[model samples]
Target: MKATLILVGTELLSGGMIDTNSLYMAEELNKYGIEIGSKITVKDKIEDIINAITYGKENSDLIIMSGGLGPTIDDITKEAIAKYLNKKLVVDQDELNELKEKFRERNLKFIEINTKEVEKPEGSVTFKNGAGMAPAVYIDGIVCFPGVPIELYDMFPKFLKWYSEEKKLKSDEILIKDLITYGIAESLLDNKISDIFTEEGIDYEFLVKDFGIIIRLQSKISNKNIVEKIVEKIYNRVGDNIFGEDSDRLEKLIIKSLKEKGKTLSVAESCTGGLLSDSFVNVSGASEVFMEGIVTYSNDAKIKRLGVKKETLEKFGAVSEETAREMVLGLKTDVGISVTGIAGPLGGTKEKPVGLVYMGIRNGNEVEVEKKVFKGSRRKVRERAVLHSLFCLNKMLKRK
Candidate 1:
């Protein structure tokens, strides 16, 4: 099967907002052996939307649209689709009542503009939105979802299941595995396991993502023995770099390790701000293992908060191994991690250039410090520094 994604929003064209719903839909549909023929992003104009729909229908078997399904006046996506399909727009009474009740529960006034969320093209199948007031619709091989990510995420799966069953679409019996690795270059990783994918029905690909390298192995025959042998060989070649498998996040793994060992963690940040702590708190149940996080961006704050000595900051200039060690040692937790770096387009010296970082990890009486010089923009440097800090913490946890 083939499909085209129609993403409608003026913000997307103007670079005010990014379109992530199309990427999510594409990935989900690919799992069922569906090919995406094209992705079209149009503005909030009715003429542009109709043109996109006309183009999508000509090139693909199905059209999936997202955006312009809101209470605002610019939301004319349904009207355009109705005009293209020659159908009248009618409001579903049940959905309208439910939407009103939702507003009442929140003690907000329900206005007439909100009625647009319940309106759909004639003879279309409507699906309830669990995350918001909007209802998704399907008519004449075209599906429409709300622009919000959470609403689309909640409704797309249900719609896919119903549509798949209604059309008797069978999923491909494909076996896939993802081995995630960090702290290694992609070229070197490919070189290490280049010769392992010679067997029939076994395919492999490498994706260099922001987190790390993903070695994806797929088997068309669904043969367990062949897949296992290939995986074992790859592991033997570069096992030390592999951290987790499919859908495994670094922060989640670190939290799991701390819980398993009955240990607590604390973080002291400099260049990364609160991003290092924010990553941990984003995971569920992290409160059990996370004690506190302190951001000491200035030298005075470092001296007062993490107890870094004034003399140490003056000597090492805040982004050095000595300052990092002192920061981690002052945390007083079962496990302490500290990050100090110059993630900058400015404030770089001849001795300490931009993207130069020092990470310190303290486990009981032992303390280890690492110095690294990364390359990238300011945001990229900060993000990479956070990941490296977690990697160092994971290694320290493994030792004990």
Candidate 2:
């Protein structure tokens, strides 16, 4: 089955709010083998909402609309859906009584405008809202949800249960696996696994995340063995670039690797502040391998805290390979990583433009420092530097 998602909110259209509801709905629908045909975001205008509904009705088997269900006059989702379906908007007396009882329970008086929450399109199946006042509406393959995330979350399961039973959908499960890869570009990874993507009965989706590229393989085929073989083929083709899969994060993997090798890690960070160390500490059980982390933002701090020499900072500057190496060597640990960079919209010299980063990783006596010039905003530069440091640490641990 195919579905269309419509997000209705002036705030979403005006960039004041993010539409996370669509992401949740898409994931849930995909789990039931329902393919998303289109996703539309429209402002709170009545005409636009009706047009979106009409478009979705023509193109999809199921249309799910979220947002604009409230007591306010601007919340016109129910009215617009009623107009589109050519149905009367009538007050559901039972739902109205429920709303009044809920307000009474909270020691608040229910106003006349609160009746909007109980109004539904004529002949629609109304699901009681356990989380909020507005009832969820479903009619003629269209499901309407309130804009509130908590209410939607509480009501979605009931809708899903109804949908499964009404449609008599087959029990064949949709299996999805995310193969997380780093240190590789999307185009290169796609080219390497082009053959596996073309194999029958499987679908592939490549998503670029902050850490790296996530190659998602989804199959509805009943046989699980075939899917495993396909995943194994991709793994063999990609090799070490594929670090972990599904919810396996890079920091978690790094911490796990360090623990397995019985090694300790310390960091001396400059331009990235304590971001590299923060990533390491984000993983649970990080205290088992993480030793210490210090952020020496200024030359004085570098000298006082990490023991970076004045001569190295003067000659090679703070954003240089020599400074990074000195910082790493200053930290006393089995594994030492240092990052010094010029992440800035300002304060960049002609010789050292913005995003000039030097990362140093030392395991035992062998130390490797890499000089890279990335191009992006200050936050992007810092984020990229942190990932690069973690990737370098992963390589060092693998070598041991």
Candidate whose TM-score is highest = 1
Encode model 1's per-residue lDDT on 1-400: one tens digit a residue. 7899999999999999998898799767856656789999999999999999999899988899999999899998999999999999998788889999988988999999999988899999999888988889999989999999999999999998898888787666556778999998989998889888898777789988887889998765458678888889989999888888988878999999999999899999999999999999999999999999999999999999988999998887899999999999989789988999999989888899999999998888889998998899999999999988888778777888
**Candidate 2 structure, TM-score to reference:** 0.81
TM-scores of the candidates are 0.92, 0.81
Error of 2 at 240 (Å): 2.7
Provide the RMSD of all predictions against the true structure, rounded to 1 decimal. 2.3, 3.9
Off by over 4 Å in 2: 14-20, 83-140, 146-162, 165-172, 259-266, 281-293, 332-336, 362-366
